[model samples]
Target: MRAAVFTALCISLSAGAHVLLSANPLPLGMLAALSAGVFAVAFLLAGRRERGYWSIAALLVPLELAADTVFTTGQHTCYGQSGGPVAGSMRSLGLDLLCSGEFGTPLARMTARGEALAGTAASPWLLLGAHVGVGLVAAAWLRRGEAALAGLLRAAAAVAFRPLLLAVAIVTVAPVRSTGRPGRRSDRTRAARPRPHLLHSVLRRGPPCPAAA
Candidate 1:
């Protein structure tokens, strides 16, 4: 529960800082400093666990994607453009890709479409990269002697535990009985065996008790 709270707080502060830095008219240098401070505090409060950092990434990434969708649709509407939902979604995805620093003809096309918003001098790519970088660092730090990739995979699994558990439960079932019939039979066989005595072997005799009497 404490981990969850810490994760939530870190993600919330990071998301808020990103939005303020991107959409507000505040001084870039000051915003950057404040954002850095907030992130440092969040990191310290969240502890040195990979899950906390991955939790931050898991929450922040989706948020940025949603924000991109809203920003794209709002910008188009503001410009009196009539792009439908599909087009708007595509534009949003393209913008998200741009924010990830995946530059190419697709980004050029998006830029040509006049999707750029004012007061966004702070690049989304930089913000996302920084977030991911921090996550990687945290994962590395927590991994210790283990492989970084393994730690990252664990963090990813931890973040997606609910869905993973559901999938696993759907695909598998518990056994109806722990012990099989064969196991019970073996126990019975052991119990029914006669006990051996040291005197029986030494005093072995034929069935002539009546003749000896």
Candidate 2:
């Protein structure tokens, strides 16, 4: 019961976030803008500038993933669900814009589309299936995209910011790279240096030679 209430509260808050976004677009926009900006700034400040380009490119991948998550969620919660009956489903469908955007949170999502009543979930699976179906179709269409820029953008996204694949790869490879230190300590240390952190602590001195000169 407590968990459900908490969930409902959270959903309500999320709904408010979307609805009230105009009240504070600055913060959200700033964060999003900064994520992209810092990625570029840090890259330029570093010697390995190419890495920066790739890192900035990689940032797009997450934003794409976020878009997919939002879109699918909206489709499921707002458009595709079955309600109490066909009539209810029809009514609920009418509320898509509000449900998908203004009230995109769980509490706002109806078990039925109507307020002041328990929402009837049309079919969670059905909603999920529709989302997946649309995703696959969109993916296929995207594959056949006509615009060169679109194709290039997609390709670059996949390479620099591949979602599921990139996430899993990072998790799997990070630990292995970190833990399985080499039989040869120096070489391994050198490899780890750039990836993890700078190694040397102190500055080298040539005071005697300078004094003699």
Candidate 3:
């Protein structure tokens, strides 16, 4: 429990620092080093635990990616841009990448442009990759050693092999309700209802009120 808590704290601090210091490469580099070192220590702590640390370490990867997406987008809207729609339709691209890995290239390009303009910002791709590396390192260093790595791989495979699980995950993580059109009801309900026949409708209308009399 202590190790899990510490790991979560480290991840939060790392993500928050990245979002806050994204505009300063020097500080971002320093943060990178500091975060790596801290994660190493956290992994070492996980090594002392009996079980479940691997799962915690595994969680760090997606959590870090998600945090980067959320915090960076928020930072961009609040600090990088004026009061507006925020990156148009591509604001949550980072989190979006989780479900659709194809967006990785576009996201990298977008960040590369921003980084070029800022002249000090770190590439989000590199930053996130480094965080993922930290989590993998922690998993490898866990007390269970090879078993931990195997478990991680197995879990990943389970998700990868099952399309339903993937779809369910996308549904769970996506902002479906928020993005959907207002007042739209479920299609299933509409489909289940019995449709009125054209003859029945005509009869109900009583021959169109006798041709309007």
Candidate 4:
């Protein structure tokens, strides 16, 4: 019942991306974005409700790929002026190799040429790859019912979904400066450091560890 409701909501949301999505007639990029969101949320809810993260995770792969493909495949033109559904999506997606915006957001931008309609800002492929990798791990975790494995997956997801979560947090609630949080005091000291010296050192050597003082 929960899964049903969850799936329904996804479909409803995606309908906007799909219906409004288009290069020529169909809004493929929008559709794909909507689909990705729906599947991601659906899988998460289903996993929790049925206690079958693996099952949901398995289905999540194709759903993600399909959403990615749909949005990517029709986003841009390959050899022509504009995309023709398939080619457009493909060309749009291929651009992601250079950048990483799956949902047409900023962090995904490498070149100013990346268009929002194309949904070429984020790397849907990277995201899809991570999902695939996690799914494999989930397979093993399910068999052993390892709570540790579950925790590991949760940690990975927390990190993986940080960008999305952060965006939501920032948009919905402005980022608040740390309130004397632990180690936060060092933030000011760190900021006051000589940038040139730090840059030269970093350039000469990789990230430094000053534990020895």
Residue 17's lDDT in candidate 3: 40
Alpha-carbon shift of residue 19 in model 2 (angstroms): 13
Return the number of clashes found in candidate 3: 0
- In model 4, the worst 10-residue window by lDDT is 98-107
Shift of residue 49 alpha carbon in model 4, Å: 5.6
Candidate 3 segments whose C-alpha is farther than 4 A from its true place = 1-4, 16-21, 24-53, 82-122, 138-213
List pairs with backbone clashes in candidate 3. none
lDDT rank, highest first? Answer: 3, 4, 1, 2
Report the lDDT of model 3 for residue 131. 68
Candidate 1 yields a Cα-based lDDT of 0.45
C-alpha TM-scores of all predictions: 0.26, 0.21, 0.32, 0.29
**What is each predicted model's overall lDDT from 0 to 1?**
0.45, 0.38, 0.51, 0.48
| Candidate topping lDDT | 3
Query: Which sequence of candidate numbers ranks them by TM-score, best first?
Result: 3, 4, 1, 2
Tens digits of per-residue lDDT for model 2, 62-159: 33334334533444444444421123654466543334222233433422322322133543343344444444443343334323445576799888
Please, what are the lDDT tens digits per residue for candidate 4 over residues 1-213?
A: 444444443343332233233222224345444655765666565554234556645654455445545544444432123532234465566633422223322222433432454455454454455546644554454435435556778899999999999888789986657757556668878975877645544345666688845
Best by TM-score: 3
* Deviation (Å) of 203 in candidate 2: 74
Kindly state the number of residue pairs that clash in model 4.
Answer: 20
Query: For each predicted model, how many residue pairs clash, with residues at least 3 apart or on different chains?
Result: 0, 5, 0, 20
